[model samples]
Target: MTVDPSLSEEIIARAQSYPGIRAGIARLKDVLKAPSYQVVPEGEWSTSLSVLQESTVPEWPPEARSVLVLGLHHPKNDPRLDWWDRGNTNGNRRLMEISESLKQWLRKELHLGAYPLPYHVEWGGLFLKDAAVLAGLGIIGKSNLLLHPEWGPQIRLRSILIEGDLQPNEPIEGFFPCETCDVLCHKVCPQNAFSSGAYRRPSCIAQIDSNVANKVPGGEIDENGNSILVIKYCRACELACPAGK
Candidate 1:
């Protein structure tokens, strides 16, 4: 389906009018130290998109024109951001707040219908790193996290899909940050999660699903199976990066 012809101009104008939209985006950059940020291209992350449509959540509008993808830095100093508090409440909470706030502002200011997506595969959340790369925000490192030029692999992400179509943003051109840097992320894994290059995409997905299964009502289970103490933050890769230090 084609985007509404006027959707681009309208959304851009609306985004300009609200200092909040700009501020919100800027706040993300400030907090995350993200070097690159942009909206996702239409049809990007189709797998997750299909999951959302089939979910219990309502269907996306026919003209669901664009997505606003935001990134937050998860620096090594603040490893807690990536720690898995049982059920991943803290990380997910931060994602939800940014997503919901952006949507609320867009709805009120632009009359746009916005949806804040959940952050789980079962809940129809897509692979965030894939979305971030497609959105031109960053490249996915060998460590399996999205790495920005300024932030390395220390970033988290959330997004809002809007009903009206907007002009899609350009994809950032770049390659892996690990290309030149020594593979510090792989070396630092306590569990040696990256030891043998054992993470096929399908296996990775299964692992995440299985890890979260039977989690305490509000807890997270990392690959190591230590429970309830902390839910869902893992950052061996992010911590190892030398960028933005």
Candidate 2:
């Protein structure tokens, strides 16, 4: 079914009226340019997009017609947010907070049903990059993260599918900024994660499998299969870009 134009306008108006919601969106934009976050669009990154659709919740609400995607900038300076620290929860806390706040505001102001999604692929949630693209946030970079025109690839994302036919936001069109720049992201990886050609889905799956199989409680793993808990940050590709910095 198509989104109801009037309903969408109403929702947009209401969303704009909420100071918290507006502030949160502003914070997201600010964080993207904070020298640490990146913005990748969704359409260009089909591999990640495919994975996300496959992971989305099997049964979405009948009324869930549009999605409101939110992003949190995770700059390299604050590397801890990307870490699977303690219970693998620290990195996701910001996402959780944004989702919760958005949901609360939507429910209170618009009387709409919203579902806060999870990050893991196994949990049936779509990729943040895909949602961001649909939400007109950014394009997906070769590095596999969402890249915004203003903020390269240093952002975290959260999304909620609304259970009402709302107007979908216009998407950013025909913007490819990474084409002329030298590929610096590939050069900066300490682990040379991008040394090979673009990531092959099968290869990545195999590597992740190997990682999970060898993972020991509270320890790290290197190529030799030793437990060290180093948790390498893979933002080399993101850091290599000169966009939002």
Candidate 3:
């Protein structure tokens, strides 16, 4: 079936209609050439229980023409959104639900093929921060987080691959939030991830490893009144940033 030429607007509008969601589009070809794709993915124990595993590569669909990137703001007040439990975070689960709903809507109403991508780059997922930036959602700040205009670096991202072509959003220009700042985000890191003037991914991963070692009980309780232990990942750099406050 031929795709609706005006489907991009509808898709973005429908996605943003959900509370606290911000959406944008990027051409699959452009996203393939994104900076993140140029580098090799690291094999580490950041979230997955496996330690020092081989990097997982995604098998991109040959016919996919565009990507719809979604970002859900993670406020500091609601830290649970970023906590990991049973291998997933509440924020990521929320994004998955939203992506699934939008994918079904496109397939059923518009006769378009859409599939939600996974969250982990090791699990066949796109580098979401790269996709989000290409989709005009935000800029990658010094802390190595996507800095949205309104949410700064406090947003979680996900994406969907679409068989039909959609117009890519223009990336944000001249919006470097860290350019004039004192880099407080860097100073706040427990692992000194930015000590070398560039983000040391290994250092950051070490903190995540620590968070896993010191897991906390989640708010929800099971039928036995025993709550699952959730990993509260470190976000000192993200919280120290004054940008979206």
Most TM-score-accurate candidate: 3
Runs with alpha carbons beyond 4 Å of true place in candidate 1: 1-58, 174-176, 195-228
Which 10 successive residues of model 3 have the least lDDT summed?
48-57
Q: For each candidate, what TM-score against the reference?
A: 0.63, 0.65, 0.90
- The CA lDDT at 228 in model 1 is 42
Q: Write the per-residue lDDT of candidate 1 for residues 177-242, one digit (tens) a residue.
A: 567888887777655667677333443444445444533333446577854464343454567777
Off by over 4 Å in 3: 1-5, 41-43, 46-58
Q: Please provide, for model 2 over 1-245, each residue's C-alpha lDDT reduced to its tens digit, 9 standing for 90 to 100.
A: 56456665565455445322311121123223432235332222122434323234666666665666666666667776775433443446766666677688778887888777666534645555666776677776666567776557877766676775555665578877767667676666555556674533443444444444453434446579866452333455677777654
Assess the local accuracy of residue 206 in candidate 1 as a C-alpha lDDT between 0 and 100.
Answer: 45
Better of 2 and 3 by TM-score: 3
Model 2 has an lDDT value of 0.57
**Which is the winner by lDDT between candidate 1 and candidate 3?**
3
TM-score of 3: 0.90
Worst 10 residues of 1 by lDDT: 22-31
> Which predicted model would earn the best lDDT?
3
Clashes of 1: 19
- Pairs that collide, model 3: none
